[model samples]
Target chain A: DTAVSQTPKYLVTQMGNDKSIKCEQNLGHDTMYWYKQDSKKFLKIMFSYNNKELIINETVPNRFSPKSPDKAHLNLHINSLELGDSAVYFCASSQAFTGIGEAFFGQGTRLTVV
Target chain B: SQQGEEDPQALSIQEGENATMNCSYKTSINNLQWYRQNSGRGLVHLILIRSNEREKHSGRLRVTLDTSKKSSSLLITASRAADTASYFCATGGGTSGSRLTFGEGTQLTVNP
Candidate 1:
């Protein structure tokens, strides 16, 4: 069984189009995160949810919104997507919100906005 | 802002040789972790060393943490072609809302 899984492994859309990426984890973790890796392979944290509650919201643009219906699922919705948003997004889960443990990551979703 | 910065942005080594990567962080952390990502894949957790721990060993991977210097190092012994990938060092804890801060990553290529 895949410990962490995200849907739409690849996404291609035009600028100004809205899209969403769904993520789910079966690792029984309490904390989940969304990260973006750019062309230079620099990874940055976007959002974090713990037990379905928003815990960490970075300096991300207002277009990107994350919703966690429950502890197992966290989805990212981007409105008015722009060319700068093109990157690989990864969903990961850890044991707790302390962030002291190792995390499990999904295969990642490669988003391309032309 | 990124908290960790990895040294030697890229490294190329022959099979059976040892590969070493170092990481330096800006702030104090409760723990540090090493992750590996293959081309077109997500990051995979490799090893983690806590602030109180000096070193840890897992299989052929060895991790050392120095809180005093705010740095860490990962050593891969007998590296193989399969080990060729981008290795990242991430720092956890601090006032950053429990988010793990990742470095730029080190691209390691092992020639067969």
Candidate 2:
């Protein structure tokens, strides 16, 4: 079984179009995160949810919104997507909110906004 | 802002040679982790070194941490072509929540 999985492994859309990426983890974790990897392979944290509650929100643009319906799922929705939104998005889950535990990451979704 | 910065944005080496990558972070951390990412794939955890530890080894990979210097290094011995991937250093810190700040990543290419 895949510990972490994200849907729409690849997304291609025009600028201004909205899209959503779904992430789910079966690792029975309490914390989940969304990270973005740019063209330079720089990984940046966008949001974090613990037990379905928002815990960390970075300096990402307002167009990106993350919603966690439950502890097992964290979904990212992008509104008015721009060219800068093109990047690979990864979903990860950890056992706790503490930094001690290792996180399980999904295969990642590559988004391309033209 | 990125908490960690990895040295040598790119490295190339032949098989059987050793590869070393350095990372420096800005803040105090509870633990530091190294991850490897193959092209078009997600990041995979390689090893973790806590703030209290100075060195750790797993197979051909070795990791060292210096909290006073706020730096860490990952050494891979007997490199193989399959080891061609990007290596990233992430710092785990924050008072209440678990947040890992990742470096830009070092691209290592091991030629057979």
Candidate 3:
């Protein structure tokens, strides 16, 4: 069984379009996170949710929004996508808190905006 | 500003050789975590060493944390071709909300 799973592994869209990437965790974790990896392989934390509530939001533009329907699922929606928004988005889930806790990650969602 | 930055962005070594990646952080922290990412994959948690602890080992992976120097190092012994991946150091704790800040990363290639 996949501990963490993300749908739409590959997405190719045009500029100014909107899309959503779905993520789910079967580990019964309370916290989930959204991370973006750019072409240079730089990973940046975009958002994190704990118990279906927004816990952390990085300095990302408002175009990107993260929604967690429950502790098991967290989804990312990108609005008004631009060329620079093309990257791989990863969804992860952790048991809770930061005390030596390990995070399980999904495969990843590769978004390419032309 | 990136809270953490890793040294030697890339390294290539032969199989059975040891690979070491160093990471330095800018601020104080309660614990540090190490993650690995293969090509086109998400990050995988490897090992974590806390600020109070100096070193920890799991399998063939070893992690060390130095509070004075504000740095950490990850060592993989007897590396294999399958171990070729990018390693990242993420800092957490001592911050509100418990959000993690990840370092740039180190790409290691173990040629069989």
The top-ranked prediction according to lDDT is: 1
Can you tell me the DockQ of model 1? Answer: 0.79
Model 3 agreement with the true structure over B1-112: per-residue lDDT tens digits: 5788998899999999999999999888878999999998888999878789999999999999998999999999999999999999998877523767789999999999
What is candidate 2's lDDT per residue for B56-111, written digit by digit as tens? Answer: 99999999999889899999999999999999998886532479889989999999
Give residue B90's error in model 2 in angstroms: 0.3
Local accuracy of candidate 1 as per-residue lDDT tens digits, A1-114: 999999899999999999999999998999999999999999999999999999889999999999999999999999999999999999999996884589899999999999
Interface RMSD of each: 1.1, 1.4, 1.8
Which ranges in model 1 have alpha carbons more than 4 Å from their true place?
A: none
TM-score of chain B of 3: 0.96
How should the candidates be ordered by lDDT, best one leading?
1, 2, 3
lDDT of 1 at B72: 94
- Positional deviation of B95 in candidate 3, in angstroms? 3.1
> Which portions of model 3 miss their true places by more than 4 Å?
A98-100
Error of 2 at B58 (Å): 0.7
- Under CAPRI classification, how is model 2 graded? medium
User: What does candidate 1 score on TM?
Assistant: 0.98
> Per candidate, chain B TM-score?
0.97, 0.96, 0.96
What TM-score would chain A of each candidate receive against the reference chain A?
Answer: 0.98, 0.98, 0.96
Per-candidate Cα RMSD to the true structure, in Å, reads 0.8, 1.1, 1.3
Say which candidate scores most in DockQ: 1
